[model samples]
Target: MELKKKPTKKDNFVFLFKGSPLNDFLYPFKKAANQWVARYIIVTFAIIIRCAVGLGSYSGENQPPNFGDFEYNRHYMEIVTSLPLYQWYLQDLGNSNFMLKFPPLYAYHSFIWGIIGKLINKSWFELNNSIGCQDIDLKSFMRITVLFSELIAYIPSVIIYTRWMGRHYNKAPSIDQTIIAATILFLPDLAIIDHGHFQYNSFLLGIALIALNNLLYDNLALASIFFTLSICFNPMILYYSPIFFFYLLSLCFVPKFNLIRLIYIGVSVLLTFIVIFLPFIYSGGIQLLSHILYTTFPLNFNILHQSYPNFWSMTNHLLNNNIDLSNLKNLSIILTILAISPSCYAIFTNTSKRLLPWCLASCSLSFFLFSFLIDETSVLLPWMPVTLLLNEVDADVISMICWFFNTCLFSLMPLLKKDGLLLQYFVLGVLSNWLMGNLSWVRKFVNIIIPFISQRPNATPVLPHSYSWTATIISFYVTATIILSCDLLQIQPLVEIENFWEISNTFLSTISFGIFYVWLNFKIYTIHSLKAKSD
Candidate 1:
């Protein structure tokens, strides 16, 4: 027999060299050029929306003051700017005694805006005192100020996140990647509008993301400093700091020397503490830290007067006239430690099977799980996993979970607060119980008979990665488009209980929750099945 057509030594060497992935450049890094364009479109739209709201009437000339009225925002802005530390750098807050009225950061920003208004017009006193008046002509500008600050701060986070995520895995983000990034940007429903027309969180959230990204990559000092700076803007972001500390502690046993990294971590913590405490060190720095930490972590339930009534807070309210937190300082610490311990242990042991995405996911989930059950906080939940969950290209599981959650959130847009009841609860009765709020017979009938024929009124997940018609036509995307269209067209909601989509909203929420449960369970089972097969 003739000799087999085997490769020569040179052929084998060239083939082996070419096959190595060591020198390959990550495509996502190159995709940065495209990322920038997409990023612009996303931010520009957000900015324009903010500008519109900023210009829109906060108080209805004819419509009565309701949940999201201009008065609510204006009053809050005034209160925020009145805080002692807010305008410490300026003399205006000093003269006006703004310290007693608002939080430090709130006053600080007001001073800056006041200065701008005065510069553009005639007098500082007139501008500052009458900032919201049409005569001052500053309300529109202030609105723009509040909105742009948030939008601008939030945009840069994607850059670092994209790079770190892309480099770790060395790939361009897929379509799912863009969706995930977009989701993170759009997660907080109220945050967007609140920051858009009346408030600010972009600065704090942006700083928090920077700190987290750095800490994840082992740049502890930079991370700590970034965190400290973020705290100065909004104190509510520190609930997840334990996760970072635990991350640092874990590096102590990296199986290889990382002494420089350890130094960086120590420096980071020290710098953060200094930044946070420098102003109040004389007043009582440690006390300030403890107080801020307690108040900031997950935020106090009552900060927003219309807080989502949770089991704890609602129960507390019933037992007393109000929810008493007189004994909560230590309780909160204990709760946080207990809640975050699993992640800490996993991080320290370097034994977490789900560190990267799970880190963000765990915190995001914890915020939702442990907070006072507000609808607004639900927005932040998806970003945790969506951005960091790029370990495998076929992330069908993650995508499905995100899709369901998006549905639940989108469905909730129409219902916020009305009278004594959260509007969504009533909607649940309608959609889940066929528009019946009280008739048990009808509810029972719907449950017993409808289940056999119709699909449950559930938050349905988008299909997995295949290019099926269903996958391409994301229901949440469709729903969102319709809702946006309705808002633009000033069309009333569909199938209203009173006159709009009533029970259907609640039905969609239930469906979303159901789909998320199923999709998560499926992922858990698939991973286990694969592991079992491999073993």
Candidate 2:
């Protein structure tokens, strides 16, 4: 009674490509089966892309006397391996350029990597002689060290976080979780900064993510330990310190004043710090601890801002050397504290784990926009929390995150340009936008314009409305075109201002960051209000 349906044209077309490499590669994903296979494949692709990007030039590739952070990292390893624990922070104090300013755990990490480098190539870690050294083998070894650090630390944390999210919140399916993890891993800023520009930011961020995950699981002691370790690894982790402190404090009193939990967390944190600093304390004394603190939080009063796109950079142009250094420093401290206080207050009042990422995003963005001595790389702080938010299926949240992520990358254009990473920057930016589906609108527009061209079936816009999205895309295009033209085409400034192009880039980025900061604070407040209603 039923006749078999004849294969249609679409079915015939699909059959023609069924055994092709692309179809075979996408089979697991298409079927949504064997999620682990798909995840492994995606992760492998991400790693290959990262390694390929690492093959490009790094910060200060050939510049001497002021070779950038890459050289600083290599030099720090040399100091750690060659010097005593007490003398680690004392090296090159007269030359601020070469001084060891990071925390002890960083030095310890460098020491480990340095020993490995020594084993691989004896000359790579040679003290004093290694300064400004640019051997190809040495470069490869150093780049591998960063990649290895991410594998052991960063990537694992992301996998664990996504697994937890899949089990709990939204109960996202396995394939969806894998895609989310891959998106975070493909985040262009982290890859370009760590792999191309060279830093151990991912290692520190991974520890911080693990700490946040522990906090979510109500493992207070473990959370404290990992968070303390994160801070010990990099003082930049201090940006998230206020939120962590307030959240934990809220836990102590909200249900009831639980003295036992308080003591447990306090002891865990104190012990973690003690263990990290024990070697230095034993080698030197409490004075050494003071010295370490001083090195970690040095107040550079000379420069208003180091070309970082923030409140200070914008003001620096306006003030034009008229501002007093001491007064401006105090003002910056006050403003930063005020800016972060509301987020801290929200977390303390709400004490809900769901609000943690929003609070963290608000607090860290506050610090990046308002704090003194900010670095362009500090944008990564807020970005870490924002990336965690991708677990939500909210369209508004996803759209805002895509916009903010692109803004963060744009803020680093001057630095990337200075380091000869413009090509890598452009490539990674396009790749990230494509992965996020932010470029779907452009693809749709292309098909509309061409009329006869076939549109891709999967090309769906991430945002529902195209009007606002199109406006944003056009604004970014115009500004980026202008800035690149001015810098690359060597167009002279209309006004007689030194570093005009750099200043203009910084100011424009500051405006963008300022808008996002305001929106983020409002969003945090809205989240808290809704949470209160539910409670």
Candidate 3:
């Protein structure tokens, strides 16, 4: 018979996970408080962090000619709340210039929130007077909206999903589920973008999470409905639609395929679209709806979204900015389809719930990497699936995700800095790192100053001693340092160049994201091959 060694108190400190040392320092508190208390504590901490970040400047603090996304969102609310249903998307006044570019569901959501905003302060939605509004009460109201959305929708969705997955798979303990849920809620990019940068991303993401939760429960019809709702709220969620399409279609091929379920899902989706769009059709006819569709998926912009880190962005920069990919829109669409096809195929072939998140990440990342005219904020999309994998998975996977999280933050450095969010970035980054046990590596540097705190072995080493891995780690760190130095020192551009720091950051981010893209593709291919061999 095999003998098992007894777990020491130190091992008990890592009880949130079995035989894992991640966040060992937090174990004492976990032990002291019950699971519910610990979960609430983490949720409260996440909310507090968001509220703290809300104090920073928003997208366009005082800019006049045309403000940034903050002003655009305010305009959206004003139109949705004050304008007639048909006229909401067609508002062309100077102050109402942003108009309702999003789908009708999001417009209705904004309408409700705008009513609340009006209740708080009448001037907030007072048509032209609300233009470029930046009062403290307005800011507070906006922040509260995001927080409330997250609290009511996103946080609960993630927690329920994680707990459901844990129970279904029996993969890890309850504490691990709570930790994963909390960590997903505490992701810095989501908090920074939604709360600090000012948007309704968490709400959209929450709806998507609920869709995935329904999928986990094998409630395919509800999953389809929830996903339809998500896409209506933010059409960008369609980036993952291809994989979902194949996955759901594959389900129809399973044994004893239920025609009733299929019809139910189809009707649910059709009714949803009808309910949201029928009013618009009644008010303004198909032409107004066509115009709304045109604005939602605008194609006039150039390939790069102001040097966003993507394939076209880097390619254009490398070719001395002479290549006009705007002329190759058809080719761009073709390549994006090609890039995402493999992952969709994998998901279709696998059709396993365990592989869903990975396949989702793969497809969404392919879109982010190869699709035309993606923004930095869209990083949160791929991150949603990746973040869902932060349970007691492989340590290497966890470490890779940690690095990717940091890369996502670094990629948005220029945007974050422009919005005066540097402090939030630094503080939240450190806190998230500490929470994930990524800061254990800091003990090595800390031991150089204070020796006692460094004795515990790192649960996840920052870098392996292998040549390729070490080189990659060192190069990434060096690149990050250079980018930070360039930003902090306000490096002046050469005579021929403008915003050189931004350009460099964009280039580096593109390279890092490209590496990750390759890794994801490789993972998808490997999983498919292994499964094929097993079959």
Candidate 4:
């Protein structure tokens, strides 16, 4: 027999990762040139998937009386373009069906897109007649606008972020970078909401991601500008405001009091807001600004929860009749403040760059879980920061990231179902889990059920501990099964409750979210301690 050669360090390293999920997934792109090609292919595939999803049924497709948000978006565009600048918000306030509730930057965005629509087909955006216009060309034009927004803002941000992280944080290969980008791009919630359900959420999130990318590079001034612009586009970004404020404030005193840096960031933020609101300010002054602010923030105590799978939503059934709305709203505010305090304090004291994403995740999760006036789609806000942590080296962190994403997607099922997106939901969910190497147990279970279906012989478990992963997998399937069975089978509630299944879904999701919130805060504190020790 021939003597076996001694294994080199590189050989051992390669062997160590031979059957690892990332390695297996990237096996095709083993060469640098192939990795480059794979990156472009992945991006192209993502855009194609997005475009395909856009072709599906949107919110309120042919629904009469009061149509859904797609119609609201179209209406906003028409009003912004047709009416004078000063009348935009005023007109929206008067029109109950279509409220221009977003910030002025959104109004500006609507105006730009509206102008494009006018160019494409003048009658589609005609003054009063365009309110409920269901023209095929208009639908295509609107969907294309959302797609273009993703290409211009969201896709580029993810690419730049993953490239930077691959180079610096993990020193990962280009294939790994491409995989990360794919994971973010293929997120089911965003695709469903933006493409299937019809919204420009990706555009706002893209600006926020650019701000986060700036934070990674210590570009404080630019980060401030982009973050302010993101908030101007949608006040929903305020969910992340506390963490940003605490982290950036801590930077001012780190090593020494950097007054100049603070002023620079402040001025950058102020100038950005001023520029975005300049037209409204010039036309209608403080009165217009106040109206915009009120409409945007509208602390309406009337409805405690609107299909949000959060703490308030879970308890709304029991509390709605028992408690006063105003008091309940105040209690929610207090709970949210308490929930976010620890993460903010940790970042304020630690101020490490690595801790920023965790802090952001924690803060946004707190907002989603406890803040009042939340919509189900608001889950995407917290999910955004968690996406940044996918490339973390720790297995537990990776598992938690997967768990968090699943919960976010699960929470939006009711809304997606209402929009007639069940098919897209299931398709995207399976594709995302496969791409991220999650839910391997489910695949194995399916393989066992059908002997002819082949399984990956060397597939790595997402979590090293199979028992914990199994429990999570079972929980997800069970909850999903119960919810779908009730809805699809039209099962009556055992208890005589209206919307029993919806309430149960909200409650179950809130429990998962609550557990995740605790786990994430614990992780943040652990990170702070580790950084302290390293220092």
lDDT of 3 by residue, 11-64 (tens): 432343432233453345555545787678778888898899898889888988
- For model 1, residues 464-500, the per-residue Cα lDDT tens digits are 5456525443664675566446544657544232423
What is the TM-score of each predicted model, taking all chains together? 0.59, 0.91, 0.92, 0.91
Clashes (N, CA, C under 3 Å) per candidate: 21, 0, 0, 0
What TM-score quantifies how close candidate 1 is to the native fold? 0.59
State the weakest 10-residue window (summed lDDT) of model 1.
Answer: 16-25
Tell me which of candidates 2 and 3 scores higher on TM-score: 3
Weakest 10 consecutive residues, lDDT, candidate 4? 9-18
Considering only N, C-alpha and C atoms within 3 Å, which residue pairs clash in candidate 2? none
Task: Show where candidate 4 strays beyond 4 Å.
Answer: 1-26, 34-36, 301-305, 442-473, 492-497
lDDT per residue as tens, model 2, 1-535: 9999996543432332232233334446856645778777877887898888889999889998879999999989888888877999988835677888888889889999998888888777677787889999888898989988888888888888877876776565565666677778888999999989899999999999999989888899999999999999998888999999999999999878999999999999999999999999899899999999888866663436477788877887788856667577778889999999989999999987778888899899888877775675888999899898877656556766777888889888888888888999999898877766666566557877898474445322344355765576457658867877777777765334687777888887888777777777887898899988988
lDDT of 4 by residue, 1-535 (tens): 9999996543432332334454565668867664667667777888888888887888888897568889888988888988899988887534576878889888888999999999989998777776778888888999999989888888889888888877786666666677777777877889889999998889998999899889889999999999999999988899889988887898998778999999998999999999998899899999998989998776773445465687776676667545566577788889999999999999899987677788888899898888875675888888888988866656567766777777778778888888888888889887777766665557678877897575564333455465865586568768777777877787776335677667777887888878778878888889899988989
What's model 2's lDDT at 457?
53
lDDT of model 3 at residue 474?
Answer: 69
RMSD, candidate 4, Å: 3.4
Candidate numbers, best lDDT first, in rank order: 2, 4, 3, 1
**Model 2 TM-score, all chains together:** 0.91
